[model samples]
Target: MKLLFKSTLVLFTTALLSQAFAKTTICYKKDWNSPATIEVEKLEGGECKGELSYRDMLKNGWFLKDIKIEKGKDGLNYIYTLTDKRVVEIDNATILKNEYKKLDYRPFAIKILNVTDETATINVGNLRVGQSGIVQHYYEDNKTLIVSNAYVTSSNETASTLKFFPFTDLKQNAIPTSNRKPVTGDVIIMNYMYDSSLIIAPSQDAFSATREKYKDNNFLHSDLFAAKLKSEGIPTPPKEVIQEYAISQNLGTIFFIIDNTIYVVDSKTFAILDKDIISYNYIENKRMPFYTRVEKIEKNIFTSMLDYKSWFGFLNKIFGDDTRSEDERLLENEIAAGELTVKGEVYNNYYETMLGIKK
Candidate 1:
């Protein structure tokens, strides 16, 4: 026999606000697919005054699902919904875990079976084509360092081939400093292979300079999307959900702006790779906009941060020879020419699929 109990926890703040009330409802099950237990928590304040905050949920694996705020004649009603969802971690990459309240995705780990010019083959059977992951190499120093990002171009039961985007070392002025390379023992880890980046700002006005600087570049903007959700009468999602949504769009970098500073963070590990500080001043008590100073910032900031460069030159220095034929140099051609296909869609060549010429 199974005994289930419903509990309500009421935490009161020191002072009440305008006679309003706030409530938090948690619906979760101890086991997957089991009957959910609803726990209701109420606070006696309009502003949702309580010591229980969002970050507190992480300890017990509870995550915010959604929230609702309603205005009442007395004051307001704050409704917070949460759930207990599992979070998956990969290579210590917290992008998924940090951004999604419930980290329910499975982690994919694969070994580098072989490495060639700008490409590496991994022993992956479940990774989908176009999925990306961080590539870490085990160095002789006993430290595993992230050397590059890899994306699956083709995969099968036997093996999955990945194209490498070697991280550039500006300090060493090398493609991947210290002569480290992806070896047979290195690992490719995927919580999910993120592709693009998400930039969060106070508003478009706050990001105007970076926007004009990278006019051709495309990235997900947080404020814009939130406003769209608001316009559609949809409540804004939790911060973690917002970032998780960005990951769904394949955004690998998640960063934000505070005042005049731009923090470029790695979406996977949430590490601040670089920071951009815009110079400005108050001219006679009126803030003066310095567009010229903004231009002085790196024009190729995004390119330098996100773009993939040819590590073939560096590979040649170590391996010494262009043994790969012209046909193999191009990844798309190689994928289409071979038995590799994404989602069971076979293509004679990449162009035929791109041009919509079905065979």
Candidate 2:
């Protein structure tokens, strides 16, 4: 009876804690059982606006002091500036269009629908650019897709790529040189010079079209995964114990782990994907022995740390023999240093994440 009572009390306490931390669940999914109660009010100018105020946000456990509400530059979507590391940029949100132009669409993360060698279809997202010139991949509800005729190719090992015409450009202007066909054997060389232009090398050896099954669909589903972990008594893993992490795009989850516990987050929603208690490497660090006393510093320590024995060493010695500027040499030196540092990194595949996302 005592054991039963203890368990019941623990469960009750956990329930209360969890309820206090419930967020405003804006249902972007195709189906939702209980969505957030969104209040809409009519303005004097006959416009309707959403009512996600500071008080409503605090109920979701968000520290309202860090949130700054601002209007989107496109005048369509509202910006909820958050300081936490959460990827709130990509949330599906309601749009209030104060500035609307005929066919005026804001920059957005393109929702790829189909990209075959013969045709391509995509739904452009409503993008918000921050003051720091960073593009937020979030989208408003009033997004529409555009289809263009194109060709797709596949490559081996290096990477795959998709090429399509800018629908807005094609709609506004006429271009005769836009439909240039790629060469058969060349690898696609990508160059990002501007916001609207995506440079692709015309070749089959370097790039390939995205697979058919992965196209026209949302693959990363973090929120659905988070709901699975909503039960009480879930364990929180240590942050430093995450020695390795990677975006398992094929699996639609961001994998977090090293030797013991593995956390898989939904790539789209940034929600914890694992449905069980996660354990950290509590024993790995202590498995080694410590010295009884301090040891003498060996000359090999400097040799190992500063030895550019590989190509980096050679490059560091003779970086600017050519006509390269000081800035260029410095950039190359930094790259070399980074490459050296990565050799000692505990995690190898950290860059494989979606913009190296941290949870």
TM-score of each: 0.30, 0.18
Q: What lDDT score belongs to each candidate, Candidate 1 first?
A: 0.41, 0.25
Q: Write the per-residue lDDT of candidate 2 for residues 231-335, one digit (tens) a residue.
A: 211111112111111121222233333233333333323333231223332332210001011121112222334333432343344443575455445533433
Winning model by lDDT: 1
RMSD of 1: 25.2
Q: RMSD in angstroms, all models?
A: 25.2, 24.5
- C-alpha lDDT of residue 116 in model 1: 68
